[model samples]
Target: MNLRQTINSVQAHEKELALFNIDADERIDEELRSFFRTQNVRITTAQTASGCPEEIAVLAAGETVLAVVEVETLRELVDGAGAQSRRLGVTDTAYSEVLSHLKETTFTSCETADMLYASREIEDRARRNGTGTVHAGFQRCSTIVSQQAIYEDLSRTGVSVHAYGVPDVTPPELAGGQVHAVGGEIADLWFVVYDGGSEESQKSALLAEEDSAGRFYGFWTYDSAIVDSVCQYLTETYLGGNGQFPQFRA
Candidate 1:
């Protein structure tokens, strides 16, 4: 399946996050709620007369409660320790927490900033592992100009990198990185898929479509099977028939 269809396959499942005893300022409260909504997770709040020491957040799929974490921890995620942390780095920790409990789940609408944070997280993981096949789609090659360095660094680590986009700009040199210039449905997608080179535990992917000017609707997944499928489709569709690169390995 294509990227959009792959996302739709998992988007069928629904999940929710429930907050209990969340006594926080309206601004903070709304921010917390907005954070989960970006991931396509619904939020429900309830307060108890006997106030607890900390606010609790629970993730559930239908009647099954999947994960439980402190609401304050989530607040810390969005607000960060200071100005620098608030930028985007701290949110990686928060995304880890959310991903730990929710895998193969769809995130409804992710802003460019949100997608940027997540894409970096997945790329960082592949860099640290130093082994894996990374596929990044920029929609337009001009977009790849800004990320040229990032992919170059990733390729240096022995992670095979493939950059895809419309042939709108000259392809930048990316060391071990391979640039795929083409046109079709891929022009509307923004994605990053890493096939955790020899390890299933390290597999991860971020797939989204630029539905509007700056907003993308999609999901980030750590599921190896799902990740493999995405990588397979990209490899076959873009690299197939052409002996440019070998097939993607899961």
Candidate 2:
């Protein structure tokens, strides 16, 4: 669904007593109002960022409230509000934990796409290499592959693979037949290949390329029998389809 619809869903899920506290500044409040209006939601209060102790207390009590804190206001609250403003200890402990959890659960459009791509790349490389290990240069990159795989494999009874983090300057040849690294890196690079055809004739492939630290790049492809074979391969390989990978820890 679209972003407005998504926000509406969140608002609908919220409890009736949940308050949406926004900044009192005209410009900031107007911006937030526009956002909530698009989702057919309303703000309960518009007060100075530092003037929402009651709202903060409610949120700290585990109420599902939405608060709009300006960047400057967030900084002020975290960095000591001085003698004139009362400090809301809720900001650091309760609010911070909730925000962190929300941040972890939420994914941006680009981030979701990147994660899907990374999962496919890792799975395809593992299959092409005929090995269980998928090499990544960075931990974030590896985590993306592992996390996706953990979910995908659990849903399907498929062979799982492991991820390895290698140095950027590591030789691609050492990574077996399929090297999976970020594009343009010295190691093997993975890319998505789309088949431009009708639904019945469409296909997708994961292409991998290996390059010396600076020279002699070579490429290969892992072709699938069907359009969704690539996605299925990823889901089964990492996350486990049909709950098969129950204990497969990332």
Q: By TM-score, how accurate is candidate 2?
A: 0.25
Report the Cα RMSD per candidate. Answer: 5.5, 16.5
lDDT of 2: 0.32
Look at candidate 1 and give me any clashing residue pairs.
none
Candidate 1 stretches with Cα past 4 Å from truth are: 18-32, 45-58, 67-99, 103-108, 241-250
| TM-score leader | 1
TM-score for each candidate, following the candidate numbering = 0.72, 0.25
lDDT of 1 by residue, 53-146 (tens): 3588888878888878887777767765444443322234545666455534446677677688879989998999999799999988888888
In model 2, where is the ten-residue run with the lowest total lDDT?
83-92
Candidate 2: residue 240 Cα off by (Å) = 10
